[model samples]
Target chain A: MAESEYILEVKNLCQHFTSGRGRKKLTVKAVDDVTFSVRRAETFGLVGESGCGKTTTGRTVIRLYNPTSGQMLFDGRDIAGRMNRKLREYLTSNIAMIFQDPIESLNPKMTIEEIVGEGLKVRGNRNKEDIRRQVVQMLNKVGLVEEHATRYPHEFSGGQRQRIGIARAIITNPKMVIADEPVSALDVSVQAQVINLLNDLKEEMGLTILFIAHNLSVVKYFSDRIGVMYYGHLVEVAKGDDLYQKPLHPYTRALLSAIPEPNPLTERTRVRIDYVPERDHDYSLEHPSMVEVEPEHFVYCSPSELERYREIIQNA
Target chain B: MIYDRNNLPEELLNLPASDFEALYQEDIKDEKFQTKPVGFFKDAAIRLTKSKVSIIAFIIIGIIIILAVVVPPLSPYGFNDQNISAKYLPPKMPIVEKLGIMDGTRVLKNRKVSGLSDTDRYPEGSIIEYFNVVTAKGQEMCDVRVDAYMLAGMPDGEYHWFGTDYLGRDLLTRLFKGARISLLIAFFSVLTNVFIGVVYGAISGYYGGKVDIILTHFAEVLDGMPYIVVTILFMILFGSGMVSIILALTITGWIGTSRLIRAQFYRFKGREYVLAARTLGVPDRTLIFRHILPNCVGPLITRAMIAIPGAIFSESFLAYLGLGIKPPNPSIGVLLSDGQSVLLQYPYQTVFPAILISVLMIAFNLFSNGLRDALDPTKRGEE
Candidate 1:
């Protein structure tokens, strides 16, 4: 990715977890040498199966988890693993996150007002009146009324609650948003609504986004560029439409093929590539490594396979 | 109850029976179901109100407080002054009498005395003396003043309402005075404990690693020492004054609160909302107090209610052992010790104070248990 065009850059980020007993300890490489960037006004989707460390990568970029190694630059300032008071306030004001589960993501006990206004309270040292005014405006912007401010999370529908969550995330006027499966928990109809809302806000605010999900079809529709992860390694990265049309990596190809096609005849022609589920297999050794298969396309392949893949790409 | 033709418009109330039944059921459930108001503290308050016993106990305590503050000053007698001459008398009983009718034919009889006999019966039926006595035939008579031994240091002519102690202090006055000290000790000790415990536990739980380890070690060290021993050490160091007792009681009281607050913090700190706060750049203080503490406050308040009775009982136990409040400053503990000394001769002294202590302690315990039931967020569904 071009450095100047990026609003956020994550470089070679690694997060490791150690488990098992005594000398027989096993280490799980959660986010191994993952690299991607969100351009100034673009949606960057991260796709993988469960346990692919996509969530871990998003968390690390926001510095919720201190990266074991590597760097994350938010607007050209390295934020990974280094948190100060000012940096925390800066992050709160500049970047925000929308979570997966609406029920769990919002605190059950707080009112809509307290929940949405919390970001502002944390970011700006404003008086109470100003916070309330801003909270009301944000709530109205998210299609909630003034009366809803006093109501609790349980009072609202799942979709409405997610909107409240979005209102909370955006209340601080963040420049970038890390939406971690923001719509997956809602009903299918509600999912489209939330996605549309996010898209509208993205355009209106000129925001950068890191949208993470397990669904390839959803990301294909929503993201500007897509990065495909297979067991903690970035297997491929390309323009969303290009990747959907002509995926270069085997994992990406299998993922694209799995998306249910609308028409029967063309769907039948779509290949079903049978392989081990990447989430179940331990892919630690394959990580901390990647090969440039083609211009702007990277894959984490073994040395022997890397040469073969490079040859194929060069001929193409 | 709409009857419509089969060709009626669909909008003209042709709903199915099941739909009507479902709507009725929903209405019924809505009427009966308990709903929690949003916001942690308000929800907690609603929950807390559900405990009938806590509410009653709180009222009783409030009445006691009013009496402690208002009624004592209204008393005709002071709390401390001793009338030594009237010592060791029994509880006062109201005396009613009518002099024998003396017409012109009957000689007028003086009902004041049977010439000051040790026997409880006076010579005439008109003069009533209230005392418990053993007759010469060995029957117990509670109506007339006869046995001199039961009267203790009673002078020849006086009406002592509710007999005095060995030092001639009024029992009622002493009881009230003792209440003042015992309750003060409970309140002050609880204040110190909650302050220390909430701060200590919150910081340890919030920061959780080196600070937690260090605090845990400190709490463990304090926990290892016996409560009485700790109290005695403080008493020796600071002396057995009200301040010293408060200091001693609070020294060990906070451990329980710390454990409770720490548990609450641990339960809530790792939740998604807290992590979200951290990601949003909400400072540590706001996260700890605004987000995290409110989650924990329900339990903390409940635990504090439970701790008050414990503190009161501890002070009482210390006083009963003669290590608590000293003589001249009547705590229930000191009164209890005094009662024990006189229990064989005057069981009422021991019985009244002991009963009061037990009643107060039990009331507080029931109240605290009710608070715990009401304040727990997990119990919201039940409410």
Candidate 2:
């Protein structure tokens, strides 16, 4: 792949936290050696269960949490752990985040205008009129009116609040947006509306998105390529449709089987596959690393398993 | 049949395509009726006015303030003025005298004259008469008659409203002046405490980890100290005055506010909104001041209002113990202490100051309660 084709490429990213005190000190690997690349203007979905470090990875990429050790290349420049003011400012302005909970993501004390225009103000847009105009434009684009700008977040419904969150994220015209389970908190009906709005905005703004969620179905619908994580490790990466049809990793297969089908016959007949690390592989003998099994497909497996996976793909 | 139906259906054929173009056009018109955004303080103020008890408390406080400012200077008698002749005079109502309801005049007879000459003692306009009087035991006695100048230049007989203290100082005037001193101390001490506490707490809370640990431990240590003991120590060290009392109150007083602010900061600092602001490249100063601090304002204001009454009470307690304001300055505490000594003899002295203190405390408490409810975000929009 050409270097400029990928807007963000993270290599060997690690974030470890120290817990306990003194002699009993322990390091919990929140994100361990995760590597992935997001192509320009393409959605890269990250799927994982609770405590699997999908959110951690998104945050670390945006420098919300400093990576313990890694290389993050944004716009072909290494931004991982770079503490300079200019680089920090550039990264923040270029990348924005949509948090999981809309109600908590917006300051209740601030009106919609201040919340949405905060980014512009931070980036040095001092003109009040200009900020107001831009905020109104963004709000309207997200299906809100000008009068809504003056109201507090508490007045809006969950769907409207999420739209405000979306407006705030995109008002600065960021090149990349990290949406961390943006619709997980909304009702099923509202979830579809929010997802559609995100999809529309993505196309209109040409934004590269790192979409993180535990819902595999939503991830499949929204992403071009998907990465499956388990216990702080990215176990598989493949095209969205390909991964759903033929999951390479055991964990991915297990996660896919958990999704209930609409047809009762298929739902009842579906067999759940559980991936336990102890029974899965002999890591003591040969440790697994992410390796390419096909042209654009990657899986975390040892030499023997990798050969098995390749043969299985060839047979299919 | 089809040909006949086509000929008859002119109404159906005349129907043109209905235009729905307006529906597709964006509804960008401004709202016909819009409400101006209500600010945090304005909303709180509206809520505050809704409570009747709070309004009554507010009025009481206002009246006290007016009396504190306007009453003392208008009194005929100075706070320290002493008239030995009027030392133990019971209150005599001037209105009653004018209406002839009572004759309050007192003529002292059968009393021995003093050694000082009558001409030298009495002022120029005085009328002094010497008379020989017979007592019940048939002993001869000399009596002196002198007309006394009472309140409003009334001679001898009149009512002394609120009476007088042991030294013949007007009780009403002293009470008003004492209120001024007490209120001044409360205001200053609360201001100092809140200023120090907020700054300390904001810094401690915003910069967590090592800075938080150190500062929190320091606050805990200060909190562990006995309040009255510390106050007494400060009084002894700095000597008794307004400055010393305020310093003593503030030293430990701010710890509560600081802790409250610090706890509030901790709760808000981890909130997603604050994190969102941080991710938006907002400077640390703006994040602390604009984002985090403003949310803490409601609780902080309520806490500060409650602290004012605590300060006033502390001042009075210290003054009552004789370690507060000096004698002539007349704090409520000082008045109470003096009144308590002669409480059995002249109960009015103790009763009057006690009533004032009770009213002040109740008013402050009621007002603070209203403020808390008004500023609470959770209670907003509820009746």
Candidate 3:
């Protein structure tokens, strides 16, 4: 694989949400110093449990909640700088996000046409006919027909609304898309349909996707590269197959072991690993940071543990 | 029925390959909606009509508004036309006259029984009857029933459906004319209140943080002003005209709407659709007007409708305090104040105006209640 282009580069990104003032002030480090990158035309899956800041990382990358600190470079443009009209324009024109909840993400009052065409309208496409034409085409690409355009979001079922959301995000033809658990809210049967549609679109348009989901199996099936986050920090990053087969980090192992086996007999005896950060690592002795254990495989560990991870890779 | 996989039953083993088919669809598409598209207002309208009480109230209001606009010009007796001789006539409708109710006859208590037949004191056909004669200290006295119209010597063919007030002005014409003026004030005040409230609240709630804090403090300061004092100041500045009264009503009146709108904005601003819009780089103006504001419209419209009756009542209260529309330009309040002075002598004068205002208030209130239920999306299709 000679592809060397990185479409988006995020370095030490932090997103902290704070409320109140002075004595009563409180802060939540939702996304802490997390770093990763997405290559052009590649799918990067971010997997984490609830409240692990995977979603926060995706939102911060799209500049939804402005970064508290850290730097983000998209196509070599500094996006983590101060938010101004020009930066906002630049960010919106390139990157679009698909929210998690299908019902919550869509505007209930707007027609499907208006909801999907809104992206185009924001980009200065004011011709009603042109917008309608493009919107219908995008809807069809997502397996919805032209007739559904005039209908409100509430009329459609969950899966259809999600498809409409996908249409809204990709209609602008952005180089990168942040899909935040797009199919987690859908039924199992509908989930495959949406994933396949996304795969086809990604291939058709050469789109780089930052796919965020808690579902390990879905990410395993969809991602070219995978990053595992735990409690506001990324603990492992590797190819999809390598991460699934040889999870180097303790948290990654615990997450992989948690996937229930299909066979009743094997499932009954399946070993589930529990990871306690304090017991798993001696952070007092040395600070733990990201270290490359193999080519294209990075694990978060201190100097001593990094030696062990490198040995494990060399043995395999 | 249990067959081993290694040695399956002949029929099961021989099952045709053609029998197997996939239920999983490769592509999913939504079915076309069979019903016509129902927009926000259309949905609200459908729900509103389902409420029987609201429909009745709406019709009553429509008729009253139509009459308020149509009655004053059509009625023969001008609202201010006064004839001293025709003072204090009872309602003398020609049709209801034969029915013996409101037949223009009134009982004259403590009259000399001998004077019942005196033509000069009681004109021809003026005396209806007399009864209950009592000898009070050798003076024979009785309650004498006489035709009030004839007692006042009004023309034979003439009639006053609501009768005349102490000023001898036609009550029906004056009451409806007052309704017209009162309705105008309510409508104008409510429109301005909603407009100012929506803009102010949108700015405060959408921009939140310091902008919200400063705007809220300003509104609180304004709200602290004593309402009556503000009205008094406005009256002094502008001379108690409709413009002055409407301005007074609006000064603090819009604060409620602003608060309501502000709360609605705060609730909706954090919704995912709004976040999505922000991520899409939608300008703040569009986000405020299109995304967040439309959701608030359901409550905003309901609030505006409810504000009408409140404004009308406030105007009447001002008029009651002798600050209503300038004299001779009748409002319900002015008519009411006039009727109050002669309440004992002419109860009909007070009764008619009182009944009209009461009906107007109740109608508006019921109609607005229906509108609230209708506009609530959660209550859609509910009876």
Candidate 4:
């Protein structure tokens, strides 16, 4: 594949944290050897249960949290480990992130103009008029009026604040964005509105996004490709429709089964399969690694389980 | 999906022109619009004005400041000027005398002629009389010639509005001068402490881990020292003066504000906006000072206001203990100490300084309370 095809690539990313003191020290492997890539102008959705390292993976890829060991290539340049001033500046200008909680994500004391224009100011734009012009333009693009520029974040609703958050993220015209559960804290109606707005912005700006969420249905609706994470490991990766239609991993099947169907008959009769890793997989002998079951569909399983999974796909 | 007016859909083009005009018509009401936005400080000031008690306190403080500035120069008697004859004179208001509220005394301008003729010894213009004098040791009687030239203007006698002190200095002038020194020390000490505390605390709290740990420990060690003992040590080493007293108070004064600011910084540091600023490439210095510090202003201001009374009280206490302002230059504390010896004979000496200190402390505390309530956004609607 051409290097320009993908905007961001992560290979074997690891992030560990140590807690407690002296003899009672503990190391938590928050993100353990996760690998993924986001192609240009495509949304790569990472779905997982809470505390399964999906958010941590997004943060580490953006370099908000330093990776213990990994190679994160943004535009074919390595930017994972210790960064120099030039590389940091490059990363800051080229990539941005949208946090989960809309209310807490914005500074309560700052006006909408300052919050959105902060990036330009930090990048050394001294002209106030130019900054305001760009900020107003971005605000209008995010479905906010010019009057909202001077208002504080506390005055806005959750959905409106998220739009403000989005405006702030893309004001510098970054190439890629990492949206960490941006709609999880919003109302159901507002969630759809924010998601649609994000989709529209992605198309208009030609932005590649790493959308991290715990909701399987939302991920299926928004992403072109999806990766399922369980216990700090990426267990499966496939095209969004393909993964939902034909899931090979037991964990993926369980996750898909949990999504509530709209039809009354199916909703009443659907039986959710419980996936217990200990009961299902006998990984004591050979630890499972990610293996390709078919073209563009990968699963975490041993050689024997891989053969079984492939036979099941072939039979179906 | 581009919709040009000329290329409108067939169904929309078939609609009548009158219907299109009717769809846009509605009531147009005239209303004034806001030309500018209100800032935080402006909003706080507006809210502060609504509280009646705070306004009264503000006016009282204003009067005291005016008195401190204007009264000292206009007074006929200097703060240190003395007359032994006028010692322990009772208070007499000039306005009361002019109003004829009390009878004025008349003195005879001649000396008592016991062994010689009255005209030869009195020199024709002098009045002889026996005068009573009281000393710290005992009371005595003395014969003196009262010259009319010395008693011309004061038909009754010299008037002392707040009466004269033991040194026969005008108590009113001394009180005003004392207020000037006390208020200045409080103002400058609080300003110094807040400036140092905010900077130190912001740096310590913004950068956590080893830096925070070391700085916090250092602050704790300083806080552990007894304030008065440290103040006395500073006084002994540097000697008692305005600079020394201010230094003594500031040494430990900044600890409280620094701790307060540190906690606030710690709380705001984890907030997502701060993280967003960091990811946006804002420098650490800008993030700490510009982004994080402004949010802590309300609490900082309230804390500083409350600190003033404490500073004033400390200065007065030190002066009362003879380690404050020296004797000749009057401090409230110095006046109180001076009055303590003659308190049984003359209660007015102690009463005036006591009332002034109490009024000042009460006013400052009430004003601070009002400021805290006014600046709190949660309390806005309650008013």
Q: What is the TM-score of each candidate against the true structure?
A: 0.82, 0.85, 0.95, 0.85
Query: Across residues B140-200, which tens digit of lDDT does each residue of candidate 3 receive?
Result: 9999888888888887877888888777888889999999999999999999999999999
Q: Candidate 4 DockQ category?
A: acceptable
Kindly list the per-residue Cα lDDT of model 2 for residues A1-316, writing each as its tens digit. 3569899999999998887889999999999999999999999999999999999999988888889998999988888865779877988889999999988999988999999999999999999999999999998888888888888887778888888998999988999999999999999877877888898889999999999999888998999999999999999999998898778888988898788765454556667789888898878888899999998899999999999999889887
Query: In DockQ terms, which candidate is top?
Result: 3
Off by over 4 Å in 4: B1-38, B94-159, B380-383
| Residues B93-135, model 4: lDDT tens digits | 6667466332222233232325324554344434535454323
- What TM value does model 1 have? 0.82
Model 4 chain B lDDT-worst window of ten: B24-33
True contacts kept of each: 0.39, 0.48, 0.55, 0.39
- The candidate maximizing TM-score is 3
lDDT of 1 by residue, A16-80 (tens): 98777699999999988888778998999999989999999888878788789998888888788
Which residue window of length 10 is worst by lDDT in model 1 chain B?
B24-33
Tens digit of lDDT per residue, candidate 2, span B1-383?
00122233566545667732433333323342255667778889999999999999999999998999998998777777776555544344556646632223334556544521445545444434667754555555666544433312445434455666767677778888999999999999988988899889998999988999999999999889887888888888888888888888888889888888888899999898988887788898898888998998888888887877777788888887778797788888888888899887666778878998889889988998999999999887675
Pairs that collide in candidate 1 are B92-B162, B118-B146, B119-B146, B120-B145, B120-B146, B178-B330
Better of 1 and 3 by lDDT: 3
Candidates in order have lDDT scores of 0.74, 0.83, 0.89, 0.82
Off by over 4 Å in 3: A1-4, B1-25, B381-383
Report the C-alpha displacement of residue A194, candidate 4, in angstroms: 1.9
Spell out the clash pairs found in candidate 3.
none
Which 10 residues in a row give candidate 4 chain A its minimum summed lDDT? A261-270
